[model samples]
Target: MGFLLNNRVGHLLIAIMLFVAVVAVLLLIAKVADGLRGKARMPAVIAVFAGPALLMLAVGLIYPFIRTVWMSFMDARSQNFIGFDNYVTALTADASVIAFRNTFLWVILTPLLSTTIGLVYAVLIDQSRLEKAAKALLFLPMAISFVGAGIIWRFVYDYKGAGQDQIGVINALLNSVGLAPVRFLQDAPGNTIFLILVLVWIEAGFAMVILSAAIKAVPVDIIEAARLDGANSWELFRNITVPSIRPSLVVVLTTISIATLKIFDITRTMTGAQFDTQVLANQMYDQSFVFGNNGLGSAMAVFIFLLVVPLVVFNVRQMAKNREVRG
Candidate 1:
């Protein structure tokens, strides 16, 4: 018998393996289900609870993290060890430096804008007659993928030369008002900020949903008590509402911060990190895949990972503390 071991056949073999594994899991689940009503079922329950998740975590997260760390120390071929040379280069190189600055800008701007806008919108819409509808409308953008939103906003910011009719909404408006068309994507700092606006637009809806829920969860009695004590609207919002939702606010802020750290889609789709808009994640992609500098890309990836870790850890601790307080 002849055997096929080519690419297509290899993929078929992998698919077959997956199908078998899934079938085995189904059989095991069936067996577990049959034993569910047993008196002493702790072991079966334990397996049901932890088995697949542990296996997936080991295969997916832990393995990839170990692989990435190993890659960081390896050359482009991923064979030769390069010690700290890549790290040092990333820290000092001009492109990497720009990427670092842009990443900091993204980290600062996107979260602040998204969270603040969301909180404000939530506050404004809360208790209003059309609150749900207003919230749904505002939060609709969050349903769009980052790339989709980027493409949408790309058209909005599109511009044409002086005699050509402007196709971009912003430029069209400017032209209607007898103003010059601005190159939204070519401008340095402004372009970066414009890209950030897309992230903010996408994330604001998420922030709004979370913050609105937090607002609703605030005790009515506390607000009534504050109102009776002559707490003005601003005072009630500041002293009562905000304080009550402090934990949620922190969660929103830090969650968005982490998302901002890994921002790549908007940059990649909008400008491809051109004109000084390159953030760390996009820079990593460019370094590795575009420039064929795997070492530099890996180092950038490591840096992004390092930058995100503290934020994630802090967010987790805050969440834990919040849970403790609630408990």
Candidate 2:
């Protein structure tokens, strides 16, 4: 059985068959319930449908969330209640403060820069010659994993001892130009920006794809009318294109924000969070596993959840508003 399931085709076939079976059963139940009247019918339908969904949500999300929150208030061993000490330490500790600052920088810079580049590139390639090829080339970076990209960029930024052979492309270029090699990764503040640029590079492709679709969805008639009314290029973009794609913009920004907030792989792969390059997600890992401080880890995790919740809520509200407007 294991050998049979190990094959991709066999696994897909079984999954499809199982899904069809479940759907068939659900349809059969719905058909039978259609003939029944009033309270019993409604209750039966709810039991058949909503019960499983609710149960899964409770098991998957609710329970784990509650457990994490509970642990955040407990001690390192989770043996005694420590109140707000973990939270205080997470906020005030020097390492955590640095982590928060870096995270703030990443959150602010990544989405804005990536989205801006994507939007501009999308507009440029929207109707350009060889548009598909151009967009594909731009999006090629997204195909690589963050760790893989980090490793690649790490080589690009690799530094060597003075008077040694420079193997890194950047340093090699500098040496060829009769300049000194720059510490691209080892430098603080600037190194963080360099790392953020990597995320921007990957995310720009995603942003371009989404924003390009949004751009295409803008009403051709509306754009024509705006142009006929003497609206310049900038005016058309500002008033018509942007407003038309406002919902998509919200979605792209929020999605990028979420990705930025959860940034871990690149930082870990590139810097190992050394040299003052730590963020919340990596800090959470170091605290929980590396340093054996589960309580602090849980607190950091909860803090991350807190930071994300408002953005998620805002996104949900924006989606609802868009739906309402469409309706």
Candidate 3:
């Protein structure tokens, strides 16, 4: 069995055989159940189908969540139960407090900036002759993972000090205008903003793609009617386009806001959450793995879950409302 597992040819053969066997079994079940009554057949099929999924969900998601919640109430070592002390400690610690502030800023700024820029970009491309191509170019950043985007922007924000020739594009542009090189990553409040911009860059494409679809879905007749009534470009956008895509805008904002909250990779890759650049997700990791404080980490994890569930619920509600509107 070990040799078969280690052999790539054997592994591939086993996997193929298993898939074929499963298909054969399912067909055999269907054939055998063909003569069965409706209620009996549906029960058989659901037991076969949903049983494994329910079991896996129970084991993977439900159990782990329960354990984490329990652990959050425990001590750092998980030996003794400390109730809300871990939560208090996480809330009161200076670094954790900073993390909360930075996270709040990210959750607020990233969505608004990304959504606004993307909406504008979508609107601009809507009028362009090469609409598809323009939107495609703008949407290219969504193809890159957060880590990959962070690496690209890390060099863009790179600082080589004054007079030594700026390698980073931003500093180079500043140099061309005869300005001093600023430490883009080392500063406190400003660095946080710079880091948020990276997320915005990666997220803008996603927002643009969704919003562009919504914009195009606006009724051509309504737009024409408004135009005939002497409504200008700004009026058409503010009245027709904006109102038509309002639901999509809500989805985009809430979705990006949630992404911003759970953001970890970019911040970790760029600054390692150093210099007051830490957000909740990275701080959770830092507490759990780096500092070996499971209690605090679990608290942060629970807090993140609490924060995210509402945004997800809101997005779902908005999507449902959009569907109702369409209906």
Query: What TM-scores do the predictions have?
Result: 0.89, 0.86, 0.88
Predicted candidate 1 versus true structure: per-residue lDDT over 1-327, tens digit per residue: 235457778899999999799769857975876667766566666666677788789989888778888888888777899998888888898888888898898889888899899999999989999998999898899889999999999999998899899999999999999999999999888898899899998899999999999999999999999999999989988999999999999999999999999999998998888888988999899988998888778888888889999999999999999889889
Comparing 1 with 3 on lDDT, the higher-scoring candidate is 3
Off by over 4 Å in 2: 1-37
RMSD of each: 3.4, 5.3, 3.7
Badly placed stretches (over 4 Å) of model 3 are: 1-38, 163-165
The 10 consecutive residues of candidate 2 with the worst lDDT sum are 1-10
- lDDT (Cα atoms) of all candidates against the true structure: 0.89, 0.91, 0.91
Q: TM-score order of candidates, best first?
A: 1, 3, 2
For residues 160-240, what per-residue lDDT tens digits would candidate 2 score against the true structure?
Answer: 977888988999999999899988889898899999999999999999999999899887999999889999989988999
lDDT of 1 at 102: 87
User: RMSD of candidate 2 to the true fold?
Assistant: 5.3
